[model samples]
Target: MNKFLFKVSFIILFLFLGTAKTFAQKLKFLIPDAGIVQHAGSIGYFSVGAGYEIFKNKKGYLDFNYGYVPAFKGGELHAVTVKLAYKPFEIKLSDWAKLYPFNPGFFLSYTFQEDLAYKFHSSEYPRGYYYWSPALRPHLSFSNEIELSIPESWDGLGINKIGLYTEFNTNDFYIVNYLQNTSSLSLSDIFQLGIGVRLKF
Candidate 1:
């Protein structure tokens, strides 16, 4: 099942990239402004996706992602994520570089699974036994990003800029768990670290 899902993700990415240029020329809005990849966020062990700035000033982004976790690391899992991010401020370092001090985002992740919410709410468990849905997770993140100018030689590919970012994130479930068991769980226990790169076009 994991293999099949992996193949499907690859196929979808291939198709999206294959049609990107032609679509960009005819329907500019249909093309994504950037491609993104992240490692070790709450979404999964690894994720790859595309995104576009939601605002003309490049302060916000709306992204769609596909993520996977291997069996050895955890249970083999597949997830799809949609994220909205906003950067309220930035500093210019030079003509070719800029820094965003505080980038905050909210994301929803849906994992492929049976409906655990129904089971939790049924006779097997008491009412309100589980307040959160296992299949869908909501997460919050704070990130810092550095943007760099791409070389002019790569213009034909439509590539425009490159960004490297560091992220700290926590999900609703983790936060609640930590709040309930503060002694057993440290503040760091609820937080996750992720690093990613973005290629802007």
Candidate 2:
């Protein structure tokens, strides 16, 4: 009876170990692949975010960001953004460096402000009272970034690469204004510039 019990316990222990390993693998898949921080670019004065390369070959990324604008700078704006980007081309500079010449993306931002009111229901206003919501902005962007691959010696730091990027962005409201007042509003007036860093793990 003792020998039979020992065999059964060993089998159960082996099954538990297998299940735990599978769970760990799934959890690892959910971990973010990169982190980003940026300044300016229409979302806010500054933002911090995390992202994952959702596609193979690093072709696409989905990021979530929180942004802030100080009262002195804007009006103490707070926003959350979800951005999806596509990068289709890469130039390999060396074994340790690569350049992505074009990355085009779109983002949706939701703003939070105490003094401003956003009407969600049509009953709050007559037809076409306001064409757009002040609290929600949809933006289009184009950006380029360079990646510097880290050596394996730095693996302990958990960072595999570092990237520097610059972005130009414009929102739907800006585009509409530009279209309506093309003679007065220059293309430059509708666009904003942003710079940031990305760390890949």
Candidate 3:
């Protein structure tokens, strides 16, 4: 299982690097933006990465992040995640404040840890006993963000905008469990909340 995971991770890293190289070649003049996240679903305790804004108006984005989980929590976990998000419309509250009512997205993450198995079966168990993999986690979420613009004159830095966002998410395993026991499980039991920030360049 560990060998399989290593192969998978290597392939994914290769693909990601290839894609990033192509994107950079296509947009030679534009610089990629970066952000930091904390406690996001399937992204470990904290993450930092770079991303590119897509589309003519820059309403969509693709991000790649590397996250870490400490040994004290539940052994050490190192994760790589790729996320895509879209903001359809933005509401201007004022000159300095803007609200993005909805930013729906999905993320795929893989954790490097031997203790967590991709399959849950031993020689004693029959075939197809447990189907879900704990090492590879996929999540879907909806979020809202409030952006506050920073004036260039206040600080000569290149950062022009900062955003605070909150997301409500659910994983594949949680959804499957919820479907099997709808009578016992509540919505809150299957859902998780994550909050983070974005800095625009």
Candidate 4:
């Protein structure tokens, strides 16, 4: 199953890259931006993905990510996620540093190799036994980001901007459970921490 998932991911990535390349010449600015991520809200140990900034000033963005979970951490899982985010404001702190004080986003993820029974009900079970599919997870997050613009001297390296970000995230299922048991569940109990970096070209 792991091998099958790897192959599917590879094929999807290949097709996306090919399509992006074909349209890049006509839509240079619309080409996807690539990045790597680590430890994102317990969704996976790590992930790599691409995103596109929308509008002339890039106030909105959309991303797609592929993540991996090791066998020891719930027996090998592959997650594919689609996210949309909006940056409300940007502050120029200095010549080198700029800050996006708030970025709120939502994501939907599908996990492959997950237990099918958890996602779907058996025929023997009555209707509405489970309200949500385990394979499909929805999350909401808010992030704070600081970006550094590279100087001309570093232009040779082909890197333009570096961003450091941290996010607080929670899933819909967790939130639902927390709401039902508000007296027992604290806000912190439903949230998770994610940290990562982004390099922009």
- Per lDDT, the best of the predicted structures is 2
**Is candidate 1 or 4 superior in lDDT?**
1
**Positional deviation of residue 169's Cα in model 1 after best superposition, in angstroms:** 0.8
lDDT of 3 by residue, 1-201 (tens): 999999999999999999999998999745667465657555777777777788798888888888888888777889998888899979999999999999998988888888666666577557688777768888888888898999879577777788888878888989999999999999899888878788877
| Candidate 4 residue lDDT tens string, 1-201 | 999999999999999999998887778766676464757665677877777777778888788888888888768888888888899999999999999999999988888883643456666667788888778888998988899998989999877888888878889899999999999999999999888777777
| Model 4 alpha-carbon miss at residue 55, Å | 2.2
Q: After superposition, how far is residue 199 of candidate 4 from its true place, in Å?
A: 0.8
- Per-residue lDDT over 77-196 for candidate 2, one digit per residue giving the tens place of the 0 to 100 score: 998999999999999999999999999999998889975546555666786788888788899999999999999999999999999999999999999999999999999999999999
Ranking by lDDT: 2, 1, 3, 4
Query: How accurate locally, in lDDT, is each candidate?
Result: 0.88, 0.90, 0.83, 0.82
Instruction: Write down the TM-score for model 4.
Output: 0.81
Alpha-carbon TM-score of each model against the true structure:
0.81, 0.85, 0.78, 0.81
Q: Tens-digit lDDT track for model 1 on 1-201?
A: 999999999999999998996777788677898999999787779999999899888799999999998989958888899999999999999999999989999999888755433235566668778788878889999999999998898899887999999888899999999999999999899989988999998
- Is candidate 1 or 2 superior in lDDT? 2
Q: Against the true structure, whose TM-score is highest? A: 2
